[model samples]
Target: MNSRLPATPETLAEQAADWIVRLSADDPGERQQAEAGYRAWKQADPRHAAAAAHLESLLGRLDDIRSRGTQGPARQAIHSARPRRPPPRLATALALAAALLLPGWIALQSAPADILFADLQTGSGEWIARTLADGSQLSLNSNSAVDLEFDAKTRTVDLLRGEILVDVARDSSRPFVVSTAHGNIRALGTRFLVSRQDDATVLSMIESRVEVRIDGQEQAVVVEAGQSLRFGPGSENSLAAIDGEMLETAWQQHQLVVRDRPLAAVLDQLARHRPGLIRYDRSAIAKLHVSAVLPLNDTDRSLQLLANNFPELRIRTLTPYLVIVDHEKNR
Candidate 1:
């Protein structure tokens, strides 16, 4: 039996390192506020304080290495120095903190700035279902984040990343709206889905109707039940009829149903349920088509299934968090 827990960024040690990184900000006001919050967080629990202490010690050792000049004696001394290895926990924390020090590394390793601090977020391969204060049912897909802003006039869900399904409760006075970077979707009926894609927003009408308005566009389009719409800046708007049963199976049973979809598109959806990076050559597998029902919760099994279905495809694990998929011919 493997007793070791996976070293995820959501651990206590990583939270302490996150605070340390926040405190390193150049803004004086931000640093001051962060310091206050850090103090409270450290004092709130003994584990937090211990984690912080471990991270600080790790940083101190790194600072010592940096202090040694890169030329002559310093470089030689650095090569000769044999520092004691930190415990497994401290080593993992240090690795995560070191990545954060690099520019844009946090965004690459975790999520965007807005999504990182979202009110509700799900990590890779994780899903969550919640009932809002207004009794509306909300379900978030893997690697998703959303912020809620409810007021007297409107009940808004700001989707920062990934996809969300909402079963809106009827409120005659207040309208239910789902907002993405590309546009806003107003729920005209009840159940619907809104997804924030790489360069577009997709709306999947499950039960009722939705009014979609793209950014900078005055005219709004109405999407009926069993229909899907894709809109963005450069891309032309596309509306297509969808099977309600397949859509329902996705959210209800955590299954992804596809029919003759491009391998790239299917991989993109699968990547959301997977942690780390999934690297593949776009041109290599451009002609490959996929038609299957994949299990969202078990991404490892799903990858195996893909590998089994496509004998010409090669899937290799470069690391625990990094995967490489390529056509056999590419090699």
Candidate 2:
């Protein structure tokens, strides 16, 4: 059953599948370990490479079928099993994947400029609120970074990484603009939230309106109050109406509002405010829905809240920075 004894194509494919699932883990340490283990297993035998290649080809075929925009049993099953949420548009689906995908974290860690060029930055499990020279209030989430560039003509804020809530001051002469890897958000005397994801920028208009321009696009998309949009390379998704709860800006209040969301998604959001990593069972937790207000300032309490509500869920801490959550099995 072990990888060392693998000789058949079927066994190699199973091992490859395990590696693929592990590589999708949200924890950085787990992902690195999984990748290292995968490499070692692949090198153990030449046939392993061929079997892995075959599995990859099969996945590619599945992707191609998906790209054609055809609906089948696989698509229906995927959609039905997922938690209730907004429909994922092309690039939008992969944009926020940094929370669940290993490659996204890898890309973020490799970006030296995100730190080297940042004018203001906050470490993991830290929060900061500051007022700019123009009197605009800015609140950064954990592990967030931004660069301020204000001049006579324009007020530009380059979001290096993470999320920020901006309460913009009226400046007709100097338009307040926030830029990210995917696009630019120009506030028109308003308050808004901007979060930089793995492959896109998520903009939420809280007050008045903001014009969004995807990178390399001349035309801008206007998002009014109670609306949010996600745009990425070569694709701009449509706007979705925000709920009255205003979940996007809840971070400013040090609270995470969950309205019947999957446990897996909740853990993903919680990982943002905490240091190190949070590992959990995606399939098992996805079946369980959560609806509660968790405190952002104290992640441990937030976790306790989850455990309290879901008695079957077990939360374990191997270290101060590493946590594993899973469902309790019947003996």
Candidate 3:
């Protein structure tokens, strides 16, 4: 395949798809680096203008995918799979895009004033932990998200999505806190991994004690070492005591650890650590149970292992963005 960007509405989609595959390459430069290639192509031939224009149009829609309201799959799909190239008169297109998508592009001209407790993420096969100037440690578990907020009052972070293992730094004057969409966790000098589940946020405390407040509940539970708790969504409060570090917080090492969990949950966890989405018929394996410690960086190997154990499972990697398990291989 030439992997050239397409100009027409129908073929533009195909070009976008190709850009995603190349940008998602393990290399870090990605979009910025890919620009040089496209520019070179543009100089190579006049026809490249259409491809470049298509790509620029795609890039202009960047924030639509991240907007608070009215953002959905289409926006997310495009942003997550953003292409890298110099579209036709891209600078002008980008300016026009800013005007169209925002109240005023000038308002967002400057980066946000402050960034507190940032959770910098790396792609597949890259694992790195960072200790912020503030007394806190953030370990990004490949393809993770850590939302940060810091002010004179307190240093706080929200794991809006994905997984993070944190080692709490000591500072009595200010308590370190991490909150998710489902609940808020107040750490009292503790280390733990917090994962956002479909219906609850799972918190596994590795050291010291941590208090978790669910929704609007006044009563909070203290998770001790070797204990885990789940706070339900849209509910007052919920709690549980689970093994400390056994099958939990295991992604710290870039591995997916599952022990007899529902297959659906296990697959969801895998999808988070890797790039592509995993899809299976809800009816076929809804109740299936899974157990194993698999590597998060390699989707193909992970699927191969799954297919090996469950010969009845039919697994296919449709593209860089989608994986589909249609039916049992044996069937």
The CA lDDT of each predicted structure is 0.74, 0.70, 0.60
lDDT string, candidate 1, 203-279, tens digits: 88888788888898899999988998889888688788988657887778888887888899888998889766566
With a 3 Å backbone cut-off (N, CA, C), the pairs that clash in candidate 3 are 52-87, 52-88, 53-88, 226-244
Best by lDDT: 1
What are the C-alpha RMSDs, in order, of all predicted structures?
A: 13.3, 15.4, 12.4
Candidate ranking under TM-score, highest first, comes to 1, 2, 3
Return the lDDT, model 1, position 178. 94
Residues 1-331, candidate 2, lDDT per residue (tens digit)? Answer: 2635535544455556555444544466766686788788788777676545544433433334333434322233334556654343312222212122332345466778757568999987888999999999999988889999999999999998888889899988899999998888887588888888767788877789988888777888999998889799654478888762366547657887766777887887788788666766577766899899899888999999999999998786534454667677620
User: For residue 89, what is the lDDT in candidate 2?
Assistant: 35
TM-score of each: 0.68, 0.60, 0.60
- Give the CA lDDT, 0 to 100, for residue 156 in model 2: 95
Instruction: Return the top candidate by TM-score.
Output: 1
